[model samples]
Structures are given as structure tokens and as C-alpha cells.
Target: MEKLVIGLVQTHDDAEAAAERVIDCGYTRQEVSLLMTEATRDRCFPSPDVAPPSSTFGAAVAMSVVVPDLGFVVAGPLAAVVASAVGAGITGGLREILITAGVPRHWAERYQAGVRQGGILVSVFARSERDVGLLHLVLDDPHMTSFHTEAHRHHAYDTSF
Candidate 1:
């Protein structure tokens, strides 16, 4: 099997908007890919003008859900959506949606359980060397791991196939 260097980034947007940005940026559905959230589409990326906030989770859930629906294979996002703000509801909600979206039911349950126990929920899967390279450039952090390791004990493998 050919190994494509993969990199992941946490993104914010709905499928249409994320797809639009990818297409508008000159990448075809083949060259660049993204996963977006329903809330993100519903909220329009939460304009900088807003105060008190409107949503906790955004494109992360959408990405997880849409991964299987994409016509082409999708590399995963690097970071899972962590309810960044306070008063966010049970972390299980996001996990449940994502599991139902693409994650295996068993893994999804464990992953969500991990989150409730203070585990990180986001991960990325790269499909090509170019994407992996670009991901590092976008993040600009060398310390980040280039590939998955045992540390990600709760992560789910790609289930699209």
C-alpha cells in the first residue's frame, strides 16, 4: 500500500462553506478536502461581531458526519472539536453524532467516554505527502506528532470503506 503523508487541522465551517473555500482556493474536489459541521453552516462561522457566543461545537461534528458522504476519500482533521467555551453541554453529544456519522459504534462509545474523562477528541488523517506537508506549514508547530501513536488510544480508524 502507498502511504500518503497526512496532516490534520481543526477547522470551523459547514460543508457548503468549507467546500466553497476549498473550491474557491483553486483546489478541486480531488486536490483538497474538508469536513464541516451543521451548526457551522447554520451559524455562518459565528461572525466575529457576536458576543456571548451562540454555539459550542461547530464544523468538527459536521466533518465527522460528512466524511463518509464525500464522493472521494477524505483525510481527517487534526483536532476534534472541544467545546472551547464554558457551559458547553455533555461532550457525549458530539461523540454520539460523530459515531453515528462515521466512527465505529464501539470506538465511538469509548472515544466519547474518554472525552467525559478529560480526553482530547480531535484527530487528523492525511492522504498525501503534499497534504501532510501543508498541514505542518499551516500549524507551524514542530512538536506535533507526524503520525498516530499509541497515545491516541481512543481514536477511531477510518470507516468509510
Candidate 2:
């Protein structure tokens, strides 16, 4: 089985730092995803932003999907999924993308609002319970919070596939 987790950070610096920590922790960029608005995209991620090809998660090149109000950029595993959705002519926005990434609908909606307001949603996926626990340890710092408020105030978002 697979599982998903998310963490929310309020600053571009924090977001970038957390992403680097994920990489340093030995999770490849392919297993990580980032969600942020267009403005944040300009300020934060300025690279080619192409996710490295992965045999496990298919592959995704750069493709932009402009939703009505919030123009956001997606990278990593979810990028492949969103690219497929756009190819199929589905225009669902960030909320839908989060839900597809295994976030519960309620948390997805809240994370969407947070991203809209300039927070970054860092998503990660794992194939085992041990890996998920490792992610929680790597991410459960004071700076990041999941959507669950009180229960997750010191934890990242967690879900399973």
C-alpha cells in the first residue's frame, strides 16, 4: 500500500527549506510534491521545474493548467496526475489535485485555501508504514502544520492509499 502526507508552511523560505530537508532525508523529488500559487511560484521555484522521470510514477514534463481564479504550479508525482487530468480536459483546481493525492476532501479544501493565501503545501508519498513514520519524523517540526488544526498542530498531514 501507499500513503500520502502533507505539511503547510507560511513562507517561501520555510517551504524551500523543508523541501531541501526532504531531499536531504533521501526521498527523491519524484516522491515529493509542492503546491503554491502563481505569485509564490515566481518568488520560490524558478528552475526549469521539470520532475525527473520515474519508472514508478510514469513521467511528467512541464505542463501548465490555469484554473479560473488561482493559477498554481504543481511538481513531482502529482504533476503526472494533474497533467493527465488536463489531457482528459478536467479543469478541477487545487482542491481536486490534493484529493487525488490522497488527502481527505475536507483537508484538501482547507489546504487549497491555505495555498491560495500564499502558504505552501508540501506533499509526500510512501509505500510502507515505516516510511510514513519516517516522513512524520522528518517533517513534524514546529514550523509546519497540517490541516487538522489541534490534532495535527505539530504534525504533517497523513493518509494512506
Highest lDDT against the true fold, candidate: 2
Q: Model-by-model lDDT, in order?
A: 0.34, 0.61
Clashes of each: 9, 0
Can you give the lDDT of residue 67 in candidate 2? 43
Writing each residue's lDDT as its tens digit, candidate 2 over 23-52 gives 777787567777677686666544343432
As for candidate 1, its clashing pairs are: 5-128, 6-126, 8-78, 9-78, 36-62, 37-59, 37-62, 77-124, 80-122
TM-scores vs. true structure, each candidate = 0.28, 0.69
lDDT, candidate 1, 1-161, per-residue tens: 11222222223322333334344434443433332343323333443344224323332333433222221112233222222211234234545444534555655555444433323322333344454444323322222233223333333344232
Pairs with backbone N, CA or C atoms under 3 Å apart (clashes), candidate 2 = none
State each model's C-alpha RMSD to the native.
11.8, 6.0
Model 1 residue runs over 4 Å out of place are 1-92, 128-156, 159-161
